[model samples]
Target: MDLRAGLSQQQSLKLSMTQELSQAIALLQYSAIELVDFLENKALENPLLHIKSRKAEVYQPKAKGQSQKSNDKAWIEQISDQRFTLADHLFPQIQDMKMSPFQKRVVTHYIYHLDDNGYFTGNLQDIANHFNFSLADAEECLAILQRVEPAGIGARTLRECLLLQLNRQEVKNELAERIVSEHFSMFAEKKWKQLSKLLSIDIKEIQQVFDYILTLNPKPGAAFHYERASYVIPDVMVVQEGDQFVVRLFDHILPKIQFNKDYFASLNSYQDKKVNDFLNEKQQDYHWIIRSLEQRQKTILNVTGKIVDKQQAYFEKGPTFLKPMTMKEISEELGIHESTVSRAVREKYVQTPFGTVELKSFFTNAIESVSDESLSSSKVKMAMEKLIKEENKQKPLSDLDIVQLLKENDGIVVSRRTVAKYRDQLGIPSSSKRKRYD
Candidate 1:
């Protein structure tokens, strides 16, 4: 072998990520609202681009009698939020109470220190040092805070929270009080046999106590800090026309773009070199953006149409008929990259005959079965949920029992661990926790 400094010629092919190409990729991934926002921002930079607003539909309210006016909002809905937090709700109650100024100040301090779960997280020693009061006085202030309307507000632990709620009951449950007071650890851990032996009471009574405890609020302040409801706007809709389903973009919700022809033509014919170059650059940018947006819409429509075609059974019969399909399979069928398909479906939704469903839900991993075609994990979960719903509460099915039942009833083969995982995903408890003695 000889080593020498020389230039070698090689022929190779590689994709160059030009600026316009990158923009096209980003446009494909953005949701409908995000695309509108992006275009609005770009219009400020490009003088040749202009965005046209679509007409919005307003819902009109029906006429009501004078007596019913108080029960109904007139026509418009409130958009501004003035939600109150836990601290705001508690401050006024103690402000008007008959208590010493220092005591009210201490309670106010603790109220501001309570966590979202209504737990008083401040240490007694810390409160005493801050307020120049004894630890016992601090504790008394905390007790007052706990005795407010939301019974469990200042509790430091779940056991204490339960006890606080129980104390406020009109007719107290003595057994429940004792269990939560003493054997809370055992009861929560579901050591029913040990609890039965230790308390010298029927396990059935323990079951009753468990049911009663579920009725209490664990996070008492959570209601005051509740989140506002969020609404989802779908990007596309699949409608059945005759026997074929057609995919249509929600064009009404989209912001349309029109070229500023007069603005561009006026700026043109300037003799100065810099002004001509600037106008030319802006026009190119505007055209690139328009093309990118067109490509984005076309890609999304093609991807969604393919998904609707493949998931025809699901559209016709419902989610129970969703087959095992993957993004790779869709990419192959459409002759596009897997990442492109993934980006097209990311955070995107389509309205169908069933309802507005997320695009990602149509792609589920395959679950093993004896049949030639495997079942989707979603379908198997549906079957598992059905079995659990009709299960005998006296001996709720264990993970192994669920596995056997799935194979016997649904012809789906999965391991015990998989069944346990699916059960946890469904938010169902284990056999011991789900058992009922009544």
Candidate 2:
């Protein structure tokens, strides 16, 4: 053993995490919207940088019998969403009822407290205190509000909502009412055997009750809660030219960068060293930003081009034709690090012939096939969905049974656990829950 304390210089290769490099890495992962915001903030900090944003084009529908110039209208004027909201529906009903002014005021207060699900979410005690009344009086006002056209409009609970709706029916479903009132927990949890024995009814009748319950909206007021539609901006666009797909970066949707020449020239003519240093530093920052943006667009174009090439069949046909792919595979093909490819695809969407889809969705996990070839997990999921859709509902296929069916029918061998995982991913219930007596 050599026990000696000595100082020696050693040279080893290691990548430096410079601030500019970090900014580039961050800029690579930012989506179109995020990138625009980042540039706008950066412009405020650096005097040498200027950001110019390009607005997305809105469609102007062809006028039926008018000339183009005469039919031309402002884009904002053309955009309209006159949706009837829950508040609109409730206020009219409140006005039609003949009640005392104070009573109407109390009822209006109760109406304001309801959530989007039409459930009374306000505290009765708090409301009572605010109105200088008893809790019983507040509840009375709530009851009056509940008697409106929408039977379950002012219910405090799902059970109360269902029961209120049931009570409003001329031909009452007594069994449903009892189940919701008493065995709500068991019925909701799909413990039909216990529920069947407790209610003294056949499992078939319980299943019928289950089927009826599905028709009821848990969020009744959700139908009336209208919101503005959100729009998606694609980072890349793929166009089909006969049999081949061409990839183009939608970089114009992002803001354009320009050097603030007048500001730089004016500031640079100063004699102060500090002012010159600041301007020079800002100039470097602006140049680096431009370089990073170019690299970002190039990287996105390359990655999207590769994705289009790999998923040609998918673009031509649909998602059913999506092949098994991975970021590691793309990284290897592009001779770049996997993380670079991952960042490039992160939070990015590509516009295809069918529709716009998330760039990350292009890569599907591969499953080993019986013939020693890999199968796309998406394909397996699709096949699983078809099997479950066409299976006998009375004796629904178990996960193991599905695994066997996939092996026999699709020539793809997968574990029961994998099948269960895939089933869960597809939002399909377990066999026991899926099974029905009727």
Candidate 3:
């Protein structure tokens, strides 16, 4: 029972993170776009930071008819085409509907509750209570909302969404409607045997009905929210020269940052200690940030260079040649932590001879081959995809059949369950679902 406190000397190893180290870690994780945005913000905050602008050389055509003004006008028109959002598409239709003020208000509230997928998320009872309206009125308003341009705009569930679309078909499909309404769970699960027995319909007819159901738009509002196609901006470009691949970074894509020399020089003349201290602190921050940026670029280049070197077979041949690799392996080789390697590759893209690919895509789990050598899971998946593509639609290959095919052709040894898992990962339907009666 030692109740008295006594001072004792002890030695222990302690790890601490400095502000600059923390900043470096954070900067390393930032994607190219994010890094640019961060630097822009920092430039605004630090008066001593300046971003150098690299102006592109504009070419003027000396031809007879072409004019710079016309090009400028065309460019303006291209960007000016407004994107129609789901709300924008539906609001105008709502205004055109002839409804009493109270009804319109209730309908608008319901519309607000509709999610991006055009499914109602709010409780009808809660909405009715909030609006001081009867449940009957709310239901009527809901029906009216559903009748808008998109057939399944206000559905509560997937079944309801499909049923709404089914009801709008030119040819009445009573069987499809019944399947959607009553046996939706069974239909979704693809229990063709049970469905055929229950409905007293042949498997062929059931297939036809299922095929028709597939044509219906599950997310009706998705069409209205037009998404502009985004193009990938590769952070690194690999160019093949003789026997070696030269790695080039898209440094020009990022803003060139430099210290504001004139501003720094002006600060030296300041008499106030506080002013000098503030400038000095800001200068240190500016320098540290610059060094971090440089380090980030260097790390990315080094990591990507190693990846390119290792995945040379993939670059020379195709995706099928991609070897199994992990972050741990790269981290060990580079003498860095696994997390650091992960950060370096995250959201990064590399432009190769084949195409621009995500850096993360290069790393995949290894599958054991017949020769006891490890094979990339991606390569196996690619092989599986090829087999499925060439498969007879009438008799789609089962997971067991795929495993056999891989063993015979590719000399790969994988379980049926693994094949099934890979197929699922590839978004391929089961054999029963994929089978065609024709």
Q: Write the per-residue lDDT of candidate 2 for residues 403-430, one digit (tens) a residue.
A: 9999999988889999999999999999
Q: lDDT per prediction?
A: 0.89, 0.89, 0.87
**Clashing residue pairs for model 3:** none
Q: On residues 385-436, what C-alpha lDDT tens digit does candidate 3 reach at each position?
A: 9999999999999999999999999988899999999999999998987888
- All predictions: root-mean-square deviation over Cα? 3.5, 2.8, 3.4
Question: Can you give the TM-score per candidate against the true fold?
Answer: 0.88, 0.91, 0.87
Model 1, 1-438: lDDT tens digits are 778889999999999999888888888899878888898898898888898878676654455654566436543355567788888788888977777989998998888788888998999998899889899998899888888878999999999999999999999999999999999999998999899999899999999999999999999988887677977788899999999999988767677788898987877856888989998898889888878877777888999999988889998999899999999998999999999999999989999999999998899999999777889999999999999999999999999999998998888999999999988999999999889988
Task: State the TM-score for model 3.
Answer: 0.87
lDDT at position 289, candidate 1: 85
- Candidate that scores best on TM-score: 2
Worst 10 residues of 2 by lDDT: 68-77
Residue 6 lDDT (model 3): 94
* Superior by lDDT: candidate 2 or candidate 3: 2
Question: Model 1: residues >4 Å from true position, as ranges?
Answer: 59-73, 76-89, 112-137
